[model samples]
Every structure is written in structure tokens, then in C-alpha cells.
Target: MAGPSYLVNILDSNHVSAPKGSVPSTTLALTYLDLPWFPSAPMQSLFFYEFPHPISHFMQTTLPTLTQSLSLTLQHFFPLAAKLICPPPPLKPFILYSDGDSVPLIVAEFTGADVDHLTANYPRDFKLLHPFVPELPPSTMSSDGILVMPIMAVKVTVFPNTGVCIGMAHNHVAADGSAFMHFMRSWSSVCKSKGDSTFLDEESRRPFYNRDAFGDPDGCNEEALKCYWHWISSWRENLAGPTKEISSVDKVRATFVLTRAQITKLKQWLTTQCKNSSNDSEEVKISTFVVTCSIMWICMIKSQENDIQVSTNGDDDDDDDTFYYLLFAVDCRNRIGFSLPVTYFGNCLAPGIIRAKKSELMGAKGIVTAGKAIAKKVKEMESGALKEAEKGPSNLEEMFRSGHHVAISGSPKFRVYDMDFGWGRPLKIEFIHIDDGGSLSLIESKNESGGMEVSLVLSKNQMDAFTSNLAESLKAF
Candidate 1:
């Protein structure tokens, strides 16, 4: 059975352009590091803002104010308003930001829903919230067969007397999470100042567009292209039939909160266990991210193992031999040895992977072992691993082809909580595009407390098993 069906009325839809004469027409080249994520899923985020006043107050006052401020902010972020013009291969794609470039902004009204239930700290059927998310233009294959992508889209849904939610769909290649946060913060600044153009600081108002500052001494560009093409070729060959969309009926999304006390205890446990287990030169530094991610990673693996155990009637020796990999994106802003501008706009992230066996992860020292493996990868970043990032995730692709793997979607360092658009700080931030199996999202807790909120996506059965395993594992801490 389903809950009450909410009604969504589209009140307005129009393109909001950058202020006239404010931004110049320009083209920003897409780097090799950015091109691999070209066809990847668009990063989606939903921000809920609650107001004590009536919904009419938001529609009459706050709505227009936000629109004008957004326009002003877009004047500085012109690339986001432009079209991603991709040429047929061997030629790289570039953003064509001409004068009068605008982005689509949608305003809608919702009825027959409880904003409290929608914004609660637990997971509900995603369909209940799906209507609030506006659909972006899909990527198109042109007559000449080149893929054209949309850079960004926005939607604002107002829930009558309760609150409003802002939905954003952004292409991953245009900007990493840091750049995305920069744009939102700038918009919030303008709105807070009552549409003042100068409210943003000089650093926040400007985005550095130079690609050569990355110092790619080796020709990593061609290597990246080769890897990307190989992936596309393989995908086409393997998935030639009609693709089936995943049924939301069998899936569930949920957020797990890690309190400061829990995090401290987890770190202490990992540190003690790590010291006893390894004699490697690299001492395991158990940071909050390392410890927390290690526990979740181990729990997820255990849940999968339990599923396997049941399916095989407890006779599958092959389960012990399964290889698992943890892949995460490392932001290279501070890792490249030299300093790039704090506001560098394009993608400057490198993919990193850590390998482990399922049996090891489900073992007694699993959390410590996983933490050490992640620590080793972080060390590579400190040692100038960005130099090799343009080659793409070489080992990750092979592992994805062979067996089991889990990937982290976002990092905890992104200041997502600072985005205040005058109404208030966001009540929650959710990554809506995390559908692939074993995918998890990490974001700073919304309470501004020094803790983490991990969002997991899994089948109903897997989620039930994961929560149980997570509870048992935390008992030691």
C-alpha cells in the first residue's frame, strides 16, 4: 500500500540569465580528468528549508528575492549557464558560454503532505519525495552521434505552511563538490544581503579557469582518453539489449548518524587494533573519516556475506575467495605539492582504490585492516598521486569488471551546511543519484555537530542485514 498521493502544481518555469554586461562570453576547456565523468550520472542534491510563516509568504516575498539573487550569482558562474558542446572524437569538448546564457529555474507548489514526515531523520519511500525533484534535460546523442550534456538545473518546491525544498541537478564534469558548494554559498551571500551584488568576497566571486596550473608533466590526457573509450566500448558490447531501470519498490534509502562520542570510541578501537595487527612502515593514522568509513565498509561487506551464506545454504566456499575493493575520489586541491587557486572551478579530483578480500573484511580485525588500507591510499595523495590521475581509475575498471566493489560518492570535507538562502540552513542534504549497489554517500551532519551522516542504498533485505551488523559491530566501541 502507498501513502496519500501529494499533488504538485507547476506554478512557473522560466530561464534565469546572468546580469546583462556582467559576464563576458568565453569557452572553458574540459580537462582530461573531467572528460571521463562526462557520461556519468549527474550529482543530485535536495535541500529542505522550513519557515515558520505561511506558504504565501514564501511565494510572495522569498521567491522573487531568490530569483534575482540567483541571476546575480550566475553572472559570475557563467559556465554553469552555458551548453556543454561536445565534439565528435579526437576533439575535446568545451563549455560555450555566450552572452545571455541562462539556466532553467522551476517553482512549484505542493499539497496534501506532511513536511515533518518528509524531512524527518529517517528514510521513507523515495517515491513520496520524488515529485519534488524536477527532471533535467537528458543527455542527447546528436545526428552526428556526439553526446551533448546539460550543465545544471534547479527546482524549488514550496510546501504550503511548512517549508520549501531546493533541488539541484548538476553535471559532475562541470565542477567537483567544492566548486558546487562555492556557487551555492555565493548565492546565499547575495540573498542574505538583500540582493546586494558585492556581498560575496573577491575570492568567492571569482573562479580560476586556467587548466595548465595543474602541471601535467606527463601526457596523462591521452591515457585518460584511451581509458574512457575502452570503457564506452566495453559498456556497449556487454549491455546491448534494452536496459531495465531499477525498481524503487525493492530498494530503500536511509541515513545513519554517528555521534561525536561514538566516533571517538571507534577511532580509539581502530588505533589500538591497528597497532597490534601491522608492522608496516606507514603507521595507521585513524582519522574520523577513516574509522567511520571502515566500520560502515566492514558492515556492508558482512551483510553481503550473510546474504551469500543464506543463498548457498552455507556451502559456498567461494564466498571466502571473493575480492572486494573500496574506491573513493580524492580532491587534489592541496595534494599536488603546489597551490592552485582556492576557487579553481573545474574538476581537480583523482580516483583512488583499496583492495581487500571479503573474508578479511568480515573477520575479527576487519575494521582495523580496512582502515589501514584506506590510510595507504590517502598517503598516495600526499605523495603527488595527482600526477597520475589523468590516467583514470585503471585498477578500478578492472575490478568492476571482475567482481565485488563499493564506492564512496562524496567526501566529508565539503561544507554543505553553510549554504543559507535567508530562510535558514538546510534541514537536510541528500545525494539522490546514489542507486548503484554498494554505493554510499558521506556528508557532514546537518546539525553542524562535528560528526558524520552516512547514507546507504541497498535492497530491503540487504538493509535489514546491514543495520543489524552495524549494531553488533558498534558494541565493541
Candidate 2:
């Protein structure tokens, strides 16, 4: 028997720009925070909603509103429609926007696809979700060899009367999660109000693009450039080659939830453990994010314990000392010791890393161990979020070399489920790019308050192990 398949028909494709004369042509220099991710793959996300309308009705009414509202939103966020201009060595890259620059918007129809299955919490073929997302246009080389790359692309796939999926892909150099969510909310607000943006507050209506807000006291920008140069030089050929697609034949994507009650229970258990520990002099800051991530980290490691051991058979003496790293990004808007607006555009994030030995994470008190490491890292951020910003690239390089690492892709604070594009709140929201790396995505739960929705993509066997471990660990709390 043949495997499952999905059929997508392209109906229309066009570029949507800000209103004429609304945005001025300009160039924005890359910041230190954006330099490291300059050559990384674009971030892709999918938002699923129930339309319950005919295809003709959607194209006649819904599609036009989305495109028009997107255009209006672009007037305030012109950088999203700009192009990344990368020159040769000795020169820097910047975002450039010409008068006619626009973002590609694609409208398509997904036939014979079960929207309900795609949006369900159960495991499903991960590859089925790829077609809905729009890929960034191929980078073009100018006469002088400058690489011109588009910053963003959008796609809307209609499932007849069942539902619709809105997929977006964006270059990280253009903006971070906070800035991206702001744009999303602003666009949804305008569409909900029928193109009237007066209801939005000043902070929501406009983005702060002044790069000077990010103060680099330690000259981290210069150091970051040096690191980026080394990396780009080594990966230049791969960067210039065609995009590589990962095979998802035996891979499955699944959604898991941590209810508010379960989270509270886990936090209480960790607090008690900390109090009972012999080394009680040290303080451990615990939050929903800390506890949630700690448990997930433990589960992930335990699920892959066998594979980890086999990979380290050659060095049994050091198998117990093998290091595993958990990495996440922290927003620096308020922590940078300045009065920068929460709406500051572009990337303003610092890396938060937690390192532990394999034995520590797989021990009987693994959750406590992981929680303490994460809490300590969070507490250190209080002194200075970017105190060690210069070492970010080097630390990441070391983590990859170790081959036991897991990074986070999304934040629950983004509140993606709350985005209502005049239809209603999204039935489901997913960070599609997490499949590219050993990363998991977290978002605010759609049905439960103070809860989190965690999504992961793993091999079928590993997923089964993870699910079992997750259930057993949660039951203990």
C-alpha cells in the first residue's frame, strides 16, 4: 500500500507592499544580536483556524481582508518587506528597502487533507505539514556578487469548508520573537477592526527601530563579527548551495500539554526538594518556565539514554561525564539597563544556557538537578542579561560539537493562540522550524489558563519512549 499524501493547488501568488509613499526607502544596519543568525535558516510557523466557509467565500472576502491588512501592517514595519544585502568580506550586511519592495503572499487550496487530523494532539507524519508553509525566494547574486535575500514570505491554504492554515517564514535577522508577535497582533487587530488601527495603543501600532537602544559596553559587537566571519567562511559553500530538506519518513510530530494543576504540583515538589537538600545556603529561583523546562529536559534525556550510552561506548571512562546543554533565548528589552520600549524592533535577545553531565540528568533526582541548573542560570541573568554575550557563538559551537544538546524555539509569553484575525482564536499554533534541529516549542495553551502546550518532532520509537517517560514523571508529582 502507498503512504498518505496531500494535494495542494496554487490559486494565486502576488507581492503585497505597504501603501505607496507610506514607507520611505531606507537601510538598517545589522546589530550584534542579529549577526550570529544571519546565515541560519528562516523561522517557519503555522497557524490553523476553522473557517467553515466555501472556497469562493474565502477568496472573495477573507483573503482580501488578510492581504489588505497585511499591507497596512507593513506600513509600520517596513523592515519585514526589505531585503538582506550581504556583501563580501571586510564589509557588513544590512537590510535595504526600495520603493517597490514587497513580501510574497501565496493563496492555495489543500485538497483531500484532513484538517482535524493535522491539528490533533496525536502523533502524525511530520512531513504532511510542510506544504502549507511558503519558502523564501532563492537568494540572488547581484552583478557585484552581493547576496540579496528576502526577509519574509506568507501563505494561506484553504481546506474548503473545514479550515484554513496561515504559514509564515521569516529571516531571524529581521526581527526576534517579541517583534514578530507584535507585528502579528497588529495585523490581526487591523483585520478584526476592518482596517481601522485606531483601537491599538501607540506601542502596538508602531515599532521602535532605533538600533542605538542596544548598548554594548564590552564591545561585544566587534567580537560577534569576528566569530560570524569565521563561521561564514567555513560554511560559505553550503550556504550558497540549494536548500537541503530533511527526510521525515519515520518522523512524527506530537503535541503534549502540562495542565496548570500539574505544573503547580511539580513546582511544589521541587521547592520541597530544595528545602530538604544539604546545600540549602544557595537560593534557587523557580518559575513556571523553569519547572516546565526542567521536567521536559529530564524526560528527553531519559528517553534517549540508550542511544547516548551507545554513542559513548568508545570512551567508557568519560561516559558518565558527558555534558548536555539546554539553550534558550532571553529578551533583553528591560534587562539591558535602559529605557528601551517593549516594542523595540529587530533582535534584542541573549542566550540562556544550562549545562549538566549525563549522569546528573539521568539520576533519581534528575528533575531537581535540572531545575537547579536552570534556576541558577536564570538568577545570574538578574545581575546582567548580556554579561557574557560575547561568548555566545563560541558556547554554541562547543554545544554542537558535544552532540548532546536541546534548544528551545518558542516562548509561551508570545500568546500565539490569542491572535484573532476576525474569525476567532487560532485552533492551533505550531513552530514548524523546530523539526530542523533537536528543539522543542512551547506556547500558551488554548484551552487552559496558566498552562503550556509543548510540541516535539521525533522518530516514532523515540516518541513512544518520550511519551511514556513524560507520563511516568508527571504521575510521580
Candidate 3:
């Protein structure tokens, strides 16, 4: 029942390690915290495409396109290269394509021997909730990013198993998750096509990797943001909850996907019903992710109630009735207000919060209310007109202290979408085991049949719910 000892150690490391610079130059900073004690869980071992057909070909044609894009991108954001620690030789890494234009392919190769160790943890280690993001229950860890660096003692006896961690740690600094995907798509096209991507129009690509989002000017009164940060930062301490208990609580986490078809339809339907003014010039904006999250949050919260009434939730006997925050990661690296040149990389994401009382969530519009809150939070984040996750200095870590309890998470979106390291096109793309603080990571998977295939790690019950939803989705799609 005790989680790995490394858990506390790594978490502590992130809290105290301030950025080398007291002031974060860019809106984001990615520091390598030594995981003296990383949360130990299931270790995955899988192969991309063993036979290796067009992988080399894919890499040869597409690597330059990506590297070139990254190089040009870095010139925009000066410190990006140092963050990723890219070798001077500028090694051209490979990328993978996704099932659709939305997903990505990651190739993670591991030794077969390690399979036993991973299998032992299986659903538990892989699906358990994150220890730090206590509101999320255990399963949230699965969907978020993972931390895998053996205790430095136990050597994972796996062979031939490997995986790709997020590569943006290097070039393409300002590419938001969306733009990153765009770049990946281009790489995939080059890998799958007969034409050359070497001639891509540099101007055609949108400007991303900018550093101004953090300090962008918008309606957010600096006083208001500072106040909110102080209030919210203090509030986070009480909500972290007790130790992670994987068994009873329903695992609550988040996911990011395009508006896709079905969810988009649902949003449109809801738009017609909302009494809110359609008068806004931006139009009635909604997305599949919003709709899906609304529905899921409703179900999880409502599942606690015998009826839709809020008070009824407290009387419920079920153990899974606990309510966890459904936090969505948004990348502010590219929002319009950001003035920093493209190529700024690091963790340029912010968490969108939708809080729900255990019982009130069962109300008919509970999910809808939560969804709106999510949208509203996102709006608040980009108050400066830049689509940043929050309104604050890029380097908030400068103020970090040992006793300070802060919750941060982000979406490493669209990283390996079109990576082609000259080995044909990468048959797979997956981020390596990476852990910073309380972070939830989602990366593309390697599936021959195409479509999106992802591997998430979460706590127990939350993992159960997540898997249940995933299975349902697989069937529905």
C-alpha cells in the first residue's frame, strides 16, 4: 500500500529548485529536478515496428524539415536551445504520425525482460492517481506524464524496449500544442508522400514559440491576477487532500483532442440551449473536449447521487463519491497576445480548473456549469489576449519556497506528430518517463491500424473510470 519512497523526494525537489535565473526570461521554464525518489509504478516495454520498413526513409526525408523548422524557431526565442540541451551538432531526431491529423505516433522500445516488472504493477501502477494532484485520485497519473528512472538501484531488466519523450525540449520553442501538431503533420506528409517537404513555406507556418504571453497586456488588471494567484495559491494547500487511496475514489483527470465529429455536434446542441447572449462577436464557441468533460464530470459527480439534487450526494453510501478537480492543461506558448518571438519552449501551459462539490455535481446542469467554469478559467488565463494558461510572470518559480504548495500541470501537445528521423516515417512516437512535479502528460502512441492509441497512468479507481471511459470510446468510435 505505500507508494514508492521516491515520490516525496522528487516532489520536494521540484518545489525548492528555483530557476537558475531569479526571473524567468520566457513565460515558461523547464528545469530538470533530480528525481531522487520518483513515484515507482508499472514500467512499459513495447516496440514500434520491429521489422523496420520505411522508418529510415521516413526519417531521411522528414528530419530536415523538422530540424529546419526548429532551428528557425530557436532564433526567435534565444534560450530555447539551452533548455533542451540539444547537442551543438544539432542531431536530427525522428517523429511519428498519428491516426488522424489530431493524434501523434511515438516509438518506445524497451527490453522484453522488463515486461514482468511492468506486468506486476499492471493496472495499479499504470492507472493509479497522482500522489501530488490529490484531488485527481490515483488514476490521473496515467493520463499525465510519467516518471521512470529506476531507483538507480533496480535495473529494469528489459531489452530492446525504448520510447521517445517529448522532443520540443529542443527546437520549435513557441509552437503551441496546435502548431506543434501542424508541424508534425507536415513531417508525416513528407514521410507518407512522394513530394519533398524541404521546400515548405516558412512564412506559411503560423508564428508560435513566442515569449510574450506571460507578460502580454490584456484586460487582466495586474492587481486582480496577483490577488487571484495569492488567493488560489493559498487555497490549493487545503485541497491537496489526504494520501492517495486508489481503491475508493473515482479517478478524475483530463484529456485533449480536437473537436472531432460527435462531441462537436453536442456542443452545437448545447449552444442553442444556453440563454447566454449569442450576441458576443466571437460567436458561440464550444468544443468536443468541453462537451465530453462536461458529460464525464456530470456522470462522476452524479453517480454519487440517487437523484439530481445536490444535498443527496452527502447521503450516498458509495465510496467513489469523492469529487476531484478536473484540471485541463492549456498551452499559452502561441496565443496572439504573446509578443516573444517563436521558438520559446519549456512548460508554457496552465491548468484550467472546474471545481465541483461532491453532491452538487449530480445536478442536471452540474457538468454544464463545470464546463463553463473550465471555459471561464481558460478565458481568465488568457486575459492578456494571449492564450496563456494563467496571467502571471513567465518565471513564477523565482518566488518558489520550500513550504510553498503550488499545483501546476500542462499539456505537451503535438510534440511528435510528424517526426521523420530518416527511417522512413517513425511507426511510433511516445514520450519517455518524465516527471517534474504534479504533472499529467498525454502523448501519441504507436498503433499500426492508425487512429489514436495512447497509454495513460492513473491511480486505481480513477484509473478504473478512465479505462472504462476509454473502452467505451473505443467501442463508440
lDDT of 3 by residue, 257-280 (tens): 323354555576656544363344
User: What value does the lDDT take at residue 192 in candidate 2?
Assistant: 85
Clash count per candidate: 0, 0, 74
Task: Kindly list the per-residue Cα lDDT of model 1 for residues 154-214, writing each as its tens digit.
Answer: 9998887778889997888789888887788888878877898774547645777778775
Model 2 error, position 324 (Å): 0.9
Best by lDDT: 2
TM-scores for the candidates: 0.92, 0.95, 0.44
- Give each model's whole-structure lDDT: 0.76, 0.83, 0.34
Q: Which window of ten consecutive residues has the lowest lDDT sum in model 3? A: 147-156
List the candidate numbers ranked by TM-score, top first: 2, 1, 3
Worst 10 residues of 2 by lDDT: 235-244
Could you tell me the TM-score of candidate 2?
0.95
Best-fitting candidate, measured by TM-score? Answer: 2
Ranking by lDDT: 2, 1, 3
